[model samples]
Target: MKETYEEKINRRLKVKQRIIEVAAGREKADLVIKNATYLNVFSNEFLQGDIAVANGLIAGIGEYEGEKEIDVNGKIVLPGFIDAHIHLESAMVTPSEFAKAVISHGTTTVITDPHEIANVMGLNGIDYMIESTQNLPVDVYFMLPSCVPATAFDESGAGLGYKDIDSYFEHKKVLGLAEMMNYVGVINGDGDVVSKIIASQAHHKKIDGHAPELSGNDLNAYIAAGVYSDHECSTFENALEKLRKGQFIMIREGTAAHNLSALMPLLTKQYSDRCMFATDDKHPSDLLNGGHIDYIVKQALKNGADPIVTLKAATHNAARYFLLNNKGAIAPGYLADIVVADNFADFNVEMVFKRGKLIFDGEVKEFDAPSVDETLVEKCHNTFNLDEVTPNSFKVDGKLGLIGLVGGELLTRNLGFADKTDVENDILKIACVERHKNTNHIGVGYVKGYSLKSGAVATSVAHDSHNIITIGCSDTDIAVAVNAIRKAKGGIAVVENGEVKALLELPVAGLMSEEKLETVNEKLEKAKAEAYRLGADKSIDPFMTLSFLSLPVIPSLRITTKGVFDVEKCELLKDEMSV
Candidate 1:
């Protein structure tokens, strides 16, 4: 008879038991740390005990003898945190490399959405992520990408039908379908949308949602379709409505959206069971400095959330919601993934353990990181049919309808049109180019409120599809911006006075960098400062704002490299300059 997956794992764990057995069995075992207190988030209590490990699981919870016992008499031991929702690709590093930054912060497990990569390369992208993360010290699980290309109406790099969802279910690491972004499709009874949800259910997987402005009956209908969670809730009332409707509201903090202060009030001990924390799309700088899920835990506690409640949100609640039964709590048979933190206020980590092995003791280790290839970075094509784009083709006249940008948010603020003014009206032009196929489909439109006095900003980090987006003061600047993007392979860049003003290189995937975390962060900070130097005075994170303008699913108004999209109406806005 063949052994089951559980049995196979147990057999291997038993062989790795010698070191742990010695630590727990003797009155001074192989490795013993004496005089430590444990914070049990499960029972909401602090217990005075020494935890013992054997065979990579929590073999004993009380005091024991170890071969080597160190006095850690003043430390606090807490279970390692789990990132309920995140996009690893957004970190701008391969999975193994990203581990080196987050592991020291005591993050032991992460539930990631490969949807960003899926949108650019589809199943192939997801396969690469799965293959790359399997053997790391951190436990990285996945959700089948819920919205490739985000929505059906727009032109994206890849699209998945029923076949793709079925294939994803075969991967044991796949937990569920990722966020269902096309809420309108679910409400309107689109067959393709319904099929994806049904397929997930058939595989015994939970469905995630991305309903930005849905509420009332429409929201209820989407929940009826089986999407149980959403990370796009912006307001308290909306979050309440969704929670009441049976959809778990993921309180999000990201490079673009900051919702912690607004949502913290709702996570009191009374309502804490249903809430969870997620960094939907954080940049590398924030992740490296402020911490990953650890940041969310501190912010929640400081804002009046009970420490136990916040821990549950970051651990158990998310694990249960995602149906990760073997994780979320520290128990006899759990994955032995745990963290020891300094205190409730600072939420500092003293050590991190995963699968019964010490990955970090709050600092660098001698463990070898898995080697990565340059293929994922080089995989994205930068070739565009420049032959079809003339200098005249980049300009548009008359009173032009424009997509408006709101600083500090992913959703755009709608601004109608420029009153038949010249290019001096600050009615900058925005374009999306198809870089994957060298398809010369460049969608052109006017954007208001950027406050860009004189230069053009271009980025390959366009949302969902990862196409190149350029918004600028003049056609000449626009041309220069795209050319620069091609020259660097890919990333965000600014062109002014026939010169490059600033850039953050994303040589990996033409959307990320293979550079060190500190190096990438420094470059991003410089680029942000340079954006203002080049005349974007309205927003702190202007380049990130520029990227979301191309996301077609969020709502109100958006533009893709393909065309101007009206997400509320789910159609292309008419070409008339008048709204």
Candidate 2:
């Protein structure tokens, strides 16, 4: 018999009602994990018990009778990890593909921001992210994109206002509004942003914040807007101050920005509850090499946090901060999203369960590859719309405000270069091409510290807008790379000596690939190697760092279809001297 939606949650509710009966042995448990040393995140104690699961929720504890039971053999049981904040599109793969990569790493839940896609296709893009990730091994929740185009200085294919956000909130998967990236708007009370924030609050939804290096009255004003969490804190003092403001401080450690070591020094037991772990924009290559939240947990433990406290930060703290009901705990009313590991130091998962169903079994090292659902492949369509351009399109001369890319940092420095003489000093020209529309708008500027001695690297995965961004020492090579990307619809391209060295296609909104994680890794590694050979700094992921250059919200200087923007000043950097 087919089960109706009401019938399903009803049956689960009935099981919840019979929890007393099941615990008293009057009713049988659906499944019981026996003899496990489970970490009770509530009391912060390691206790041995048989965890009873029925109707996808924890029905009982202690010794229990069950229809079926599996002996855990004294393994450590902890709540499955949660990634409080992440950009699924940043993985350069679809949500299904991203799920396959991180599930085995012990993440059972992820609060994703589809702002990257929303900025490109609006609500349809947001719905696509929601519908495509259903029925996966992990539970995926979404936060409505607060800034579709990110900033007025840049251009995106679409923009989502209050009506768009209201419609998105109707979806059951949407938790709240995503990061309010326009901190300036939040502080000054821009109409559209204010309306959206009010709408979210009216719906009883929490808001996420993005205020980098903001402090004092500015931070206070932002907090007053009801932004409850922040994942953009990249420094110890900033994180601490945000925590002091009664905000959940998300410590981010991703491929492009490695802020964990800098922030771990502040993760004491007294302040553990206010801090959580997230990889806001982790690359698939990085996810494959280290892990997802589990890697962060290991790092926290190794950094001298008490094992229980560190694990709490990885799990319960995030769920609590997000107000995700019945998640991140080993309680009677909570979900059976649990992980079994042999050790806390370099914790290796032996089994994983989501909603009482085993999704991963055996040791983590014995992981089996998961196939991408072919039906989902239909969503991976191209969004690029621009035609080919000549080498002349990328030429930059005269005084330019060079965007100095700090290694492993989201912020850039506005360095002034009077002429092209800095090319000898390793400063390179960069441009943001308006790929969504064929208006041929290209914002050209110079960038320092890429260390590119030759060649060029380009990507259509430019943040928020998903435009095409190219960086190179040679205009000819830049043209070659951008043209190759246009032909591929969407991808990262490495052009050297006027030839394509490597390319990785991202057919979905010019941001994500349909390839399997392993295949994607292989192709991306080749492309990354080519970029490294072309003189990308060793300290950075050349492809990812390039994508963020067009994000005008992060710092001193950024490019858009309009022109370079002084982010803090919220004005054009045009009068400095146009190229």
Q: Each candidate's TM vs. the true structure?
A: 0.91, 0.94
For candidate 1, write residues 1-579 as lDDT tens digits.
999999999988775565455444643333344565766767777677666655555656677765455456777666777787888877776677688888888888888988877777777778768877887888888988877768865566688887876878868888888888888889988898889899999988888888887898999899998899988988888888888778787888777788888787668776778888888776777877888888888888788787778888888788888887767776555556777787887778778877757778867465565544556434644322234344565765654457776656677755765533234565778888777667677877788767677878888888878788888777777887787777777788887876788777776556667677778788777777777876675554777777778888887788775677888878777666444
In candidate 1, how many Å is residue 250 off? 1.4
Best by TM-score: 2
- Candidate 2 residue runs with Cα over 4 Å from true position: 1-14, 17-20, 363-380, 421-423, 575-579
- The local lDDT score (0 to 100) that residue 409 gets in candidate 2 is 90
Instruction: Name the TM-score of candidate 1.
Output: 0.91
Model 1 lDDT on a 0 to 1 scale: 0.75
What TM-score does candidate 2 reach?
Answer: 0.94
Per-residue lDDT over 105-171 for candidate 2, one digit per residue giving the tens place of the 0 to 100 score: 8899999999998888877787678777877778899999999889876688888888867976767
**Cα misplacement distance, residue 119 of candidate 2 (Å):** 1.1
Residue 468 in candidate 2, Cα distance off native in Å: 0.6
Off by over 4 Å in 1: 1-33, 68-70, 371-390, 419-426, 577-579
